[model samples]
Target: MHNVSHGLNDIASILSNPILNTDSYKASHYLQYPPEASAMFSYIESRGGRYGRTLFFGLQMLIKEYLCRPITPAMIDQAKAFFTAHGEPFNEAGWRYIVEQFGGYLPVRIRAVPEGSVVPTHNVLVTVECDDPQVFWLASYLETMLLRVWYPITVATQSWHLRQTIRAALEQSSDDLTQLPFKLHDFGARGVSSAESAAIGGAAHLVSFMGSDTVLGVVAANHYYNETMAAFSVPAAEHSTITSWGRERETDAFRNMLAQFGKPGAIVSVVSDSYDLFAALDVWGTELKQAVLDSGGMLVIRPDSGDPQTIVLQTLRALDASFGSTLNGKGRRVLDNVRVIQGDGVNPESIAAILAAMDEAGFAADNIVFGMGGALLQQINRDTQRFAMKCSAIRLGDDWHDVLKDPVTDAGKRSMKGRLTLLRNRHTGEYRTTTLPLEWDERTAESDWDDALVTVFDSGKLLIDVSLTDIRHRAHAHEG
Candidate 1:
């Protein structure tokens, strides 16, 4: 069983302390994004893409797993026991308030950028506000829970940047940009920390691409974003399936794949490096050549080991020589009925390097597909994008005060002040955050700038539930 207690800190025991400065109980806290997240990418251009996804994902799970049901007397007793055992006074009044008022509902209002809109650094992706003064700290208390959105958002942004790279390469080398969505496939599910992480990160990748082997990710997209089937995969063979036939019968394994999936226009991938990749290719070119040609399906040759760029180029050259090739309009060689999929050593830099090498080798970008695993999902953290949630404004009684933390030690950690609204410049389409007084009405500020943030959650209900199809369309519409 998954341990829920392992996820939280001891400080969480005091989260509901009503004795925490009686003044703070009545204050309204504002959530804003500060300007320290630009360092996540190597270049500014690479950071441009739609962000703020998985907005309600974490909250929904938190509710179902921890807070949706009624708080029982036994639970309250355990909370008291835990604090007392640690030599701390349990705040009974605070716990009572949480039990009485916070049943199956969060009392905060969330405003955020519509999911999948291109967002720049330092702009507020989301903002939270409390209607009840006593629950002002409620949103802040949920920071640990809400911050889980960072994983999916970062994964989505990384995948989107990779899409841009592949699209640019294809645009320069081939006339068919329609295949851009399937160029990069998600093979990262098994390498992720957990099934949930795979689901979230995998769905994030599908926001830009269509090829994926992660079924859980597609399930996640359907569950969280109202998508039916957001990703796809071809019938393929792994080392186990091929090697089960033994090395001597490898040609039979190759023949079986063609015989089974080799209908008109069927696509199947066979891992070619199980024994000798060169020998496997030779067999496909000689003994299995007639079977491949007569099967009427495209054979995708997969090379799992070796230096990615060099191996892919060598494999492409060998395939061209064996299958024969025709020149496309761009003068790049398009392999006859065979293709290559390089799943090893594929990250952003290596992907760029391989595509460049392929162009130099006179091969069309469409002649190969790229599969990524660990780098796509597990290689990032919250620090990758410098994500944070901070209070920028607080209300005491009838007055509002601008709150900020500007330490001399680190300027990057300094927080923004006052209630914030994200604004999009009409002419340039760039986004920026505007700090406004708590009294400033949004209706008055709507003329000069388009308010990029919309109310997504309010009074325990989801106000905006965007479909994955719409999100994909919005994400790719601005690619030009």
Candidate 2:
């Protein structure tokens, strides 16, 4: 038995040892395949779910974080000890082979669609296969780790849909869409599973919007994708800060928030519903009215509790009544001094519904932005997008055979066979992002298809590097 007092990091230097990074059964998979099997092929895809299209992201981060490191004798020894205690067979010989022949680097090649391209569901996002004949199982052995792409992919997809939702609203109700990127702010760092999840998922949200409070995510984007300052945030007040002032001093809290962050043309968000939201609105419009007007900044009022659609409209009306408003040149009402940001229960559906309600009520989409917490990061999973990585083909001796799984229980779960090549759909090209597949290695200069899948990694080294700036640009390429 392992000692309970020992920390997880003490059990093993998990990051350095790729051996302990997978399912327990994976340790025994080396012996399960036919002895003659010389190579294996696998592919990852979104089987189809909430949205028909998925914005590819975070593969560069994954490659740098996991696959780039070479294996060592120490990792093999640690893995053997772990599998022994857990009653699983160890692949000592295979690990030794990798260390000796490949200098501890994984003898596998990976092909992935560029990180920012949007591809339809039921299509290939990444493919993997062994580079060395003897280590064929290495391709699929990495499944447990490689399949983690689903999280960032799912988050990016959800964020993109939200972007589209906001864009539609802005087009109909605002004179310009310049504010679309900052419309949905990320307040989800503290609400995610771990720091790593916060970083990955937070960076995913930045693919569409530039607002985030997850500092680690910005750091990660710079470290992994070579982009510094991937997102931005401003001084914001939380419930603790507002409520800590005591109920009687609520107005004092609002005043302090402005004094600290309300510089010229700046923006600060303050939670305004600690006591009575309507009452707070009254104070802002009357006693503190001139203070706000002379502050030379935007006061973004946040309402923490209520039905979002109703509260957002209510908040907008109150702010407008106090500061007054003006119709822009395009004829939509714009708030003069203050704006509302609905942070409670702000999901994609609720955001769309809120905007639709505002449009119906003669309120411009610019009158309010949104701050999403749980819904932005933690409220999703692999099944949210039906993500899967399945073995599609295998090489035995000199022969290649198509591999697949077709369950009688659910045809939707049927897997792919042979190998795949991701190519641009030349006929329906928009932003050069539309994708279609062909049999493996069929792409040619003679044909019109531009190969979207790239050899991003191989032999434990990063072959192709794409930066976060490049990814963000590609992700929004369709916006033009």
Candidate 3:
């Protein structure tokens, strides 16, 4: 239930999405010169004034498609001092050479958890390593991607945890403890940055979660990756609202709803707050029950006002008494078909609280759902979830030199100086790194330090499949 914090820049207002509106013909010419080049430029476009935290992911995509190889120093030099004069500290020449050497190697290494994994904060959920030292500086420029990718994944992880907590509460609240179909809703798209990021974030949440994301999420995951269509398998659902002062409105809103979506098993969401919630529940309970049964669809009631705990209890009781007669020979109940999704300021903490309340009131876990938005999506990790590019181990003077960044400030922004091996402990299985003198810098340490770099590419060809899902899964496994 702990929330991630954020800073002002992190929560900046979203930017508008339109490029080159200066002139129609000129804009069209600049924006649509060619398919490949135009595609690359969009990576940096400001979508609705907000770019996803990981701006570099878009850059990576651009580079992969257009640059198509490691950029070489020769390429930089050929730019005739434009890159050098820009005051970029990178050895423009050396980087160009390294790129030419292994640009196709796809030098970046990303170690991250699978799309679905419950991970704690401060856990090294992802570790990205670049293969070439000459291009190590490139890592710095790409911090945006690292941030963007990790943030959503982390948020998704926490969201899933919240869902699990809700399920637990509903089950314990019920008399029979039957599991319920909790449809997870994705309402974070508009609040998120871009179409691409929203889609990606939504898809990341959907792989092991559920939601409605921007279009590209489906296109990228399914059309491009050939993965299953990412969506909740549930049929249809509903919406509702509640208010302060306890006025509840059970407006035959259900009738109008059925007129649109229609019938049994059809999904309907009713906001139950216009007057006294309990009174509204007692009055409308029978009608709502009859409508759901008659339509062959399920009813989804949403409580947007009042203490979720108290409101849920009152409504549950009213619902139980009205629909109690529908329980059949096996003691199974018809209310089993209904879902109570709680929202409006629901977050991980509030979710935990409501869950505890449901348990106190004997409501089944599977009988409810949750729609998490602002409180959930807007949360940011503020512990300085940092992963900086460091040259810990480098080849020098026929041996690798160990490097260390003396502490610069309270930020702990020091870089490693010598050649180091990031090794996995065989016995404890935790991460440990060792510094080695450059002279003995072989493929690995003689003392058996595991070589962190695997042959991702060889002879201009990829040596491994580099499956994103598989890699994500491996990273998730490392989370303790």
Candidate lDDT values, in order: 0.72, 0.86, 0.44
Question: Candidate 2, residues 232-305: lDDT per residue as tens digits?
Answer: 88888999999999999999999998888888899988888988999999999998888887889999999989
Which runs of model 2 end up more than 4 angstroms from their true locations? 1-9, 430-447
* Off by more than 4 A, model 3: 1-136, 163-183, 211-220, 223-225, 233-253, 262-264, 272-283, 325-336, 382-389, 406-480
Among all windows of ten consecutive residues in candidate 2, which has the lowest summed lDDT? 430-439
| Residue 346 lDDT (model 3) | 68
TM-score of each: 0.84, 0.95, 0.62
Instruction: Give lDDT tens digits, candidate 1, residues 42-81.
Output: 0011112244322212333222333333444445555555
lDDT of 3 by residue, 65-88 (tens): 223344433333433233233333
Q: Which stretches of candidate 1 lie over 4 Å from their true place?
A: 1-92, 102-104, 437-448
Global Cα lDDT for candidate 1: 0.72
How does candidate 3 score on lDDT?
0.44
What TM-score quantifies how close candidate 3 is to the native fold?
0.62
Ranking by lDDT: 2, 1, 3
The best candidate by TM-score is 2
Question: Considering summed lDDT, which 10 consecutive residues are worst modelled in model 1?
Answer: 37-46
